[model samples]
Target: MGIRSTLPLCAVVAGTAALQIPLLSPHQQAPLEAADKTKPLINSSALQDLISGDRLFTRAKKLFDIAKLGEDEYNHPTRVIGSAGHEGTLAYIYESILQLGDYYKLDNQSFPAVSGNVFESRLVIGNSVSKSAAPMGLTPPTQNKQPVHGDLVLVENEGCQIGDFPDSVSGNIAFIKRGTCPFGTKSEHAGQKGATAAIVYNYEKDAVQGTLGTPSPNHVATFGLSGKEAGPVLEKLEKKDKVDAIAYIDADVKQIITRNIIAQTSEGDPNNCVMLGAHSDSVAEGPGINDDGSGSISLLEVATQLTKFNVSNCVRFAWWAGEEEGLLGSDYYVATLPEEENIKIRLFMDYDMMASPNFAYQIYNATNAVNPNGSEELRDLYIDWYKDQGLNYTFIPFDGRSDYDGFIRGGIPGGGIATGAEGIKTKEEEKQFGGKAGEWYDHCYHQLCDDLSNVNMTAWIVNTKLIAHSVGTYARSFKGFPKRTSSVASSAYESEAKYHGSMLYI
Candidate 1:
């Protein structure tokens, strides 16, 4: 996921004139700072103007209505994870953005039609022999669709280093423990070891719910197993007894279509454009309401709110497809953008899973605990925005785990906010967030139960408001998301020196 692209810093600095932004010192409130000296913050007249004008909540409702396009009579859409059903959802999202573009009079960019291949398998593993097995994602269909058996060699660390399994791994299938790397990496390594098949076990003590990577067309098949289901098999292997396993994967490789529906606010100063984005597609099992419906809805609301604003800089919104499939849409979008085009991107804010049924706001690890994947400036900006709104949160590293992966790789300063996912709530977090210690932030995460009814409307509304505020503020704030500063207040005057006039249009 590492971005190989570079920004044209020298060219940008050399060609653009600097613009000044009004300062809001440490004592100034963000809301107060937003009001011009002549305008009253709560003036009945201004309130009336805005109320009659485009309001965020009004726009939110309109967007909510659009999101209901594919829903059932009960307003509950069965947006199956990774199925053809998503096409209807995608069409709904596309038409919504197109309408926003028409409303805003913006030159919305159209993403090229997506062309890829996918194979969905309905796997049923019978415990006839009582050995653990589950199909992995992106796995290729079997040549004969016949079952294979072999002694399970418990490979440690899942690294699959040549030295890790020095003995001949040919013919015999390899059973690997998941960890130290991605499931895909482990599967690919097992294929290299001449493994006829691969069975990956859970790295955790409890359940092994990790995703398996797609296997190469020429490589052996791969499967994953829960810890409980795999323990006895491991026990037998430890006793030097041969383990028997059967894998039935209905894998097929066929071309698939995906897309990134993009809508931009009217072009203003090019160099200062801000991007707001969220993926629209979910895994092939559930209606990704929390996984991304939250973010997508927020973007729709923001797009509607900004529809009439005479912004200093342009704002763009994107509803990406294939994010759950390793961020394919975003990555393809970034990779295809020209160099000058890429540099014009001042900031990117991704809103993936912004709300959960159980709301414990999980900030992207901007602390860079795991990697330097976050923009320090963007992180601070987001954190400050949250603090001003009096929201509770935690900061983690970028993790290269979502659609932001593409933007971060491209060096376009970007950051995002996410409600918690599969991560367990610790005793400390439970005390702070008022959740059960043993429970996860979203129990129905990636499950069919993750529908709109389960969503915490209060948290959803607040998060949407915050996202709107951020996009609106950045649209009119100094140049773009700047590098993080200990005192964001101090950076106001320095804005004049920082703003690089608009970049050349693509």
Candidate 2:
């Protein structure tokens, strides 16, 4: 509950000159080609010469190398909040933008985020142990390593509602099956029932993994167990045999301030800005290269290459921190934006997990009525983009998951692309995007294996090129896009923001 911070965030210069630039890492040694430096201001077709699969792959490798340094030097491998890897990633991105000269106004808005890391955590059944078990995101460390043991009590299929938890679950661990609710809600209900702890088993084949969405006093300490682990615990309990279990969770929670890197072209109409954003932090496990490194670096490279161009409408790029921690960075930015500042956003775009290993040509399905007025226009833009390339594309609903949640809530039209996450791919999706069916879009979605090799270079190249195209298009014109409104309330976001009983996000 250590939440408030009095420290003023470091106001990063937006489109400002550099004070000092860090030396590039060894892996980031590619020389700026003569064409790269002198490339004339252009429209979207310039993507052909500026970015390619090879370049993106090489840059991603360099990003992985940078992530490695966090493990080697700072002892935190992944780019999670307050980790060395995350700090380094931010610095690398900042330097990349600073190197672009006077092309954009550069600003780093630093703010405190309630972020933490697990020191030592575990969940073990009386017999079989699932190494894949992960602590929920943003779990407070109060229950550190103190093993809580109980006869596993299985609530209804989903222990989401207070009524779903039985009175008998009091003084025991509530073994809840996950569905139809936020993981935090399940934990909150079980805790309200006087349960010692809560264990949420995945409704899907994979292990249950996700955050409580935000810090809540009502939520008790909880751990995620795989379906494999939960099945046995339930079976043993059903057979009247003792199904004893112990869960150990320890984390250090602190109010740590992180930066949001925002850079915008100076020549364009500042009153009407087009925004692009991607989270800069990873999870607690590996160097979340593909989970976000691909997206983060995609914007970085595009921002660098964009320096040669003159934009008509200001193009603002943001590298947000604390997305894996529940979209805190971007959420804070949007929530605190002044009336004038909020209205300037012509439209907002988010790019996250764009290069999942088993990639998909997925666009945010803003075509639905749940989205803001102009979301469909953004969706159509991406549909036309992939269709023009003869690529098979599909629509991913505009759920309040990812960094765009805040923008959508601020009444801004939002759309972006994703390459899928932990969800399993159907045979139909395989036919559409062409990878092994039945496999997770990113086999290493949030695990330690999400390293340098996790990206599908084809997806990386195409999606980033699409980003370049969008930036160039919007940077030059907002002719067909929806006009900015004065009000800041988003009906779609308000409907979706209180995700009390939704089980779809992490």
Q: Pick by TM-score: which candidate is best?
A: 2
Cα lDDT tens digits, model 2, 1-506, are 11222432212322121232222221122121222335444587885458867777777777787777668643646777787778878888888777776676667778888775777877777765657677776666534447777767778768766998889788787888876667878888888898877888875567766677667776777778777766766777767676766777777667788988877765555566789999889877779988798899889888878877656556789999888777888988988887656777778999998899888888887743676567788888888989999999987766677888788777778889999987788899898889989898999987788987788888888899899988887776666677766554456555555431112442
What is the C-alpha lDDT profile of model 1 across 381-434, one tens digit per residue? Answer: 667767876766777545566777666556566677877777677787766666
- TM-score of candidate 2 against the unseen true structure: 0.82
Clashes of each: 13, 11
CA-lDDT, candidates in order: 0.56, 0.74
Which parts of model 2 are misplaced by more than 4 Å?
Answer: 1-42, 72-76, 119-121, 124-133, 141-144, 153-170, 176-181, 192-194, 201-207, 225-244, 486-506
Residue-level lDDT for 92 in candidate 1:
60
Q: What is the TM-score of each predicted model, taking all chains together?
A: 0.72, 0.82
Worst 10 residues of 1 by lDDT: 497-506
